[model samples]
Target: MKIMNILQIHNLKPQFPCTFRTFPHHSLSGSLNFSLRKSTRLSSSSFLLLLVTPIRPTFKIFTVSRIEAPFFENNKEEEEEDEERNSATNLTEFEDLAPDGVVYQNTLRLVECSMFAAVTGLVYFLSNSLSIENYFGCFFSLPIVISSLRWGVAGGRKTMVATAMLLFVLSGPVKALTYLLTHGLVGFTMGSLWRMGANWGLSIFLCTIARATGAVGYVLTSSFLIRENILALITINIHASLTFIFAAAGINTVPSMNFIYSLFGILVVLNSGFFVFLLHLLYSVFLTRLGMKDSLRLPRWLEKAL
Candidate 1:
């Protein structure tokens, strides 16, 4: 019984063939070969036993763990839309400027308009405080011109109103009223007409009419505020001038009321025409320097002269 137990435990001569399959790899392919040793001696119930031994080195086993693969979603269209949204927004007013060298985005426009209006008021205030020449700083209309060139007629009108409001607060309602009627309206009309791509001929014509209207409006506002007749003063000045001219020529003839009114109207139109022309010459160069090529399409002769 002891010998039989040893033989069964050892099993040196197996009834079936033995094979050890290796893990799948390029270097290791075949199965393992094992040599078994028979068990020895039953000496008074003591037993020695052995099973199998491999001659060559065995390959190591690798345990694989279960893992889930992640899912992938495509959002190419949404990503493209996000990129397009970022394209229009800029960090600064000059950054990502449009072809006319201005950014027309409403949020940016509002900020710039407010700043320019403040500048306009400040310049006017300083000029008055310093008791400078009345004809000085006519270019304070820069705000209105820039607004019209950058954001169109609506922007110019907005700038004028904002500047007028600022001036009303800083100075008085009369100063504000005078500004809006004269230089403010002139800048708005001239800038808007130039930006519209109108030629010098049409632009000058339209702006002259606008300037003349503004002059009339200014006189009316001044007369109403001062509670005096400004038209009477202008007529008196005109009558004195004609009288002096006639006395020098030894021709004594009284100028009629119709003639006086006609002369005043003519003088106003002529002054408006010259003022508008001067603005054209100045802003053509000014806007050109600011990178707006089409702000005013100067004539060939004028362009060459400039």
Candidate 2:
């Protein structure tokens, strides 16, 4: 009976599964007390049994005193210092910005993106509704380019989505998609290349390809949406031009479907090339004036021309 009482009091089972690592730098201090009373009626066999019986292992449960977390006050001060530093170093331009371990820069990015999106949507709507496509069309993609040049790929992507959504709500899916493919895609592709410091030749070449792809996509999408054969119309116009040239040259040859398509593709590629070159030319001078001289690496000839 004494052994049972001692076992219960000492908790000779694995009741507390706590480990030392769980209480880091904690102080543990506890004492154990065991007492047994001698009984006059106890037989010799009972005493012998108590001596012979093995005692199970006991666990000493300590009262762990947790030290106040180290540097707890210092941590709050450090965090405050970081916020102050970030605020102090806040910049107007996010180009090549270093991570500040804070959300301030991201908040600035969101504001810039919203401003660009609003400008793009408003300009696009006005240009279309005013029926002055010829003049306003030249700058349809400027906001995208500026956003990309200032804030890079993510900024450009957000601006594009916002502009497209706004256009869809105001105009329709056709206009929105057209804007996305041609104008938005051009701005995104060229601006990303320029921001990465890509040279003029490579940037122009890749952007030309992107612009051509967007044109083809726009043509097919618009044709399907409007239930008209845009390609067929272009083929007819190309054939008419070819017939006039052939007649002037006294050549009695009619262009085949393959030949006509090839000519059409060439025209589209040339148009895309010109558009990309125009962007490079315009931005090389414009960005330089904006105190972003390093944004583009202009060739000598282009620099002289500009």
Candidate 3:
């Protein structure tokens, strides 16, 4: 029995020792390999999450910022329209306040009218016979009447007085005096008539009557006096009155005896009458457009004082 027990103990020791060594080696190697694989997987996943997270947040922030930026909605056409409207308003205001422009225009018109009257008067005196009756001096009166209506009676009178003085200096005293008597008186009368509210037709009729009366007076005076100078003067007066009558009838017929004389007389009356009517209407319309209640207003000083 002792022999059998010894053999069994020896065999068990060899087998058990070899099995324990092999088991320790296999367990340690397996556990180390599994730990390394798990660590590698976890590191890769962390890197991918860090990259994706930052990129998504940056993209979202850029989109949101762009949406919040301000933008204008007005088109180019609308802006241009607004500018045009503003410019029109400014121009209207300038025109309304342009008193200097009005005064300058009035001064220029007066100068032109005066110059025309002086030239026409000289031509008339040179072309006609020196007799007062033949001269039909009323031709020079129309410009003065027109000037008075457009600029006022004061301006008209100033031009007429200057023209009369110029004529006296250029021509002999007799011719100058005759011109003043006929033209100056006619101008003054027409101006007065216009101021008293005479329309175009009435003003023309009154002027015609005045001319006819003057002619008749001259004829009667010369016939009674029986003087050669007076006779010549009366003949001139009758010719002038006839010329005016023809002009009023709108007959453009020229006098065969004196073409220049008849033509000039007709032109003077027609031009003057037409210009006076046109300028008066223009003045009235301009004043009305500027919000004036009446063309004949009080003087500046009087208005201010009141």
Best by TM-score: 2
User: Best by lDDT, which number?
Assistant: 2
lDDT per residue for candidate 3 within 198-281, as digits (tens), equals: 655676656655554444454445466565565456447766777788899998764553654465456546655554455445
Query: Where is model 1 poorest over a 10-residue stretch in terms of lDDT?
Result: 41-50
* Predicted candidate 1 versus true structure: per-residue lDDT over 1-306, tens digit per residue: 876777678874333333323333333444555444344222322222222343354465656888765464347667877787676454444464653445446678898899999988988888888877266656867789889888888898899999999999999998888787777878887778767878889888888898899889889888988899998999989988998898899998878778989999999999989988888888777777888766667899877876
RMSD of each: 11.9, 20.2, 21.4
Q: How many collisions between residues are there in candidate 2?
A: 0
- Please identify model 1 stretches exceeding 4 Å from their true place: 1-104, 133-135
State each model's CA lDDT, in order.
Answer: 0.77, 0.79, 0.57
The number of residue pairs in model 1 that clash at the backbone is 0
Model 2 lDDT per residue over 1-306, tens place: 786677679876323232111112323333233434343234334556656986543455677898887756888999999998887667523433645534667878899889888888888888889987778776777777778888888888899999999999999887899898888888888878877888888998998999999999998997998899998999998899998999899999988888999989998999999978887787677777888776667788866776
How do the predictions measure up, each by TM-score?
0.64, 0.65, 0.35
**Which residue runs of candidate 2 sit more than 4 Å off their true CA positions?**
1-101, 302-306
Give the Å error, residue 274, model 2: 1.1
Instruction: Note the residue pairs that clash in candidate 1.
Output: none
